[model samples]
Target: MNPFSVFLRARYGKCFASREAIARHQQQAFAHLRRHIMPRSPFYKDFADQPYENWPMMNKALMMEHFTDINTAGITKEDALDIALTSEEKRDFAPMIGQVAVGLSTGTSGQRGLFASNKRERALWAALMLGRFSPSFLRSQRVCLFLRANNMLYERLGNALISFEFYDLLQAFDLHLPRLNKQNPTVLIAPAQILRLLAHAQNDGAIDIQPRCIISVAEVLSPEDEVAITDVFGVEVDQVYQCTEGVLGMTCRAGSLHLNEAYVHIERDIIDEASGAFAPIITDLTRETQPVLKYRLDDILIPDDEPCPCGCASLRLKRIEGRCDDILYWQKHDGGLQMIPSDLIRQAVATSQCEIRDYRAVQVGQHLLKIWLDTDDFALACQYVEQNLLMEAAKLNTQLPELNFHQGITSHLDQKRRRVIAK
Candidate 1:
């Protein structure tokens, strides 16, 4: 299929007019993909006789274990990893196996993931990205993407109208400042941390780029980071919820992130019904080479109770909470463990009286909490944060754990920064 045709279809075509329409589209796409992959992919051979919905959910461990057999392309896990790692080490993204683009995940979740996309997949990705990310295709656009790894999939986004540039996150920030000022890209995309850094540079007059749009990708955009970036750019910081699996969602004009229901079918694994929080079991119906059917993700997402004003009928997300493993557990008087939501921890820190520049809270043990903060008055900031957390815990009728304060918390570009973590 011509990529431009796909782009046009996604942009102007009424692919998702209603909930029923989207459901029908998903059914058709899933059926088509299953038919194409069942015969070629050995990992899915046994599932040929099973109903699509009845198939067992696949996780990262299973995918890694069966990587060679799972992929329709005859690429081994060893070879793919070598290719992806070589590109990262050399700081070159030109290498490819045939027309397949190979890249590695940041390994933030402990195990690095390898993803492969053939030429067609690359085109589809670029087209869909442009269709969603661009405000208007009629006008020319320049995009500067700050990411740890680059691949042909991103490079394919470049065209006459849309120019694409990849700014390696591993490179020094000082090196990026001059290039960013020169590029003055209309669209700036980066992780929340990088966006925060750029926001500081913009505030300090070190970088001058008035991007029409700023997108947060890869990392969870905390409330603090979002406000800082938005304040600096004078634009609502939008987000793209994508992973190695596929492009899952894009923020609409109303600034609400909606899942691309046209491409993927999401099955919510509800954890908290009251908050509409769930881990997504996604099946990317359009993916053929490496079929992602009934794949479970670790990240937790809260659904928006109110309908989006943008009127996109797709499923909307209120917030992307951190990983399921990071959800803290607190012991109650009844000896039952009560769940401490990531949002609650975030709120406690965010609403603290002292101005906190940066912070991280990690449950080091069952009854131990390690708090790191970067602020002007370390002692006062620590006291305020500890008190706020204690108050929050009291509301839940749980005793606050032993709190340890650290002077500063540093973040690295190669890893996803989680404000709240559980060890």
Candidate 2:
């Protein structure tokens, strides 16, 4: 075995052995972050004087603004971007020892951000995910990875039983489908939207191949999307909340999505007046090349206040609420703040008996709500939804905001569409 591989096995095995042991390991990890990466990086050095417990929270905007100065070992934002972009073009660049891998995201909030991971960091991620999520699969499984770009770090997954074929989403399906269908992969992983499309193709008798497992990544999977995809594919859908930032969480065998305890520590605080769902403030213990210490994320995560039935004792995320930008804001007549909850909007619409396939809500002002409903029974559906909203608002002792209903299909920039927009 390779030296790096051996090191990975040893470190991750110890970390995943038990939750208590992993906490002990994190103490050492935090020490390493303080001693080595922080002092070397100019941005982290500003926080150097602050106690680790008192480090200031950060977000995408802050990271992008001070990108050059925050990276450890004198790594610059330019270098990180160069590696990420060049690697996307298939250039091979070896990351320094203890230097984490950097990946950039096409940010939904208008600007892109960087995600860093070292060798040991990636190993811990793999261990935490595979060890708990897909224990039945191994290096012997044939894996098909569908993504926009496949990087060198992802290339490491190839082994005797674990051969991977990267299928780029941008390419024409006709060019790759025949070859892939012949290979007959044992595991298929793709974005939830793409997986649904694949399921449709199979149902239409376009493709015939069964995989042992299926993983959904990149986009959020609506309950409807999840049910349809799983039903047509005939397998339970596994979700990985991953992006250019980091592998945030993965669905375990027991179906509960668990956070990776070894790499990241997440805290939640309420940012808006709406659902009161806690927004994520992240502390990445594994990032070294560019340390993401106390970074705040815009993507709102649903917290599982209750313990999981799964035996593994790890941080549990209940569900991911849509992004902060997706939250609609309303102006009250009394000049007080009264923002409508996205969850309430979703619940109100979802409960309608009408088959409203898709919809988007735009806030015209603080008191006016412009709703777009995509269904044949637009009038009936709108009436049903408004009644629900009125009932919910009454329960909270708040007036039902005026609703202006429109009938049309909303065009999306990315493959996935946001159900609500803060206009």
Best by TM-score: 1
Model 2 Cα lDDT, one tens digit per residue, 257-303: 77766567777777653444777777777666667878778887766
Cα lDDT, all candidates: 0.83, 0.69
Q: Write the per-residue lDDT of candidate 1 for residues 1-423, one digit (tens) a residue.
A: 457776887677654657888888887777676667676888887886688766877998888778899888888999998988888889998758887777887656788777888888888887887776676678899999998778887886577999998998788878989999999988899999999999999999999999988889988888789999999899889889998899898887788889888788999999876687899999987777777889999999888857788776899888888799888888877787777887787787778787888888999778999988888888988878888888888888887889999988787766778888999
- List residue ranges in candidate 1 displaced over 4 A: 13-18
RMSD of each: 1.9, 4.3
- What's each prediction's clash count? 0, 9
RMSD of 2: 4.3
Q: Alpha carbon lDDT of residue 186, candidate 2?
A: 74
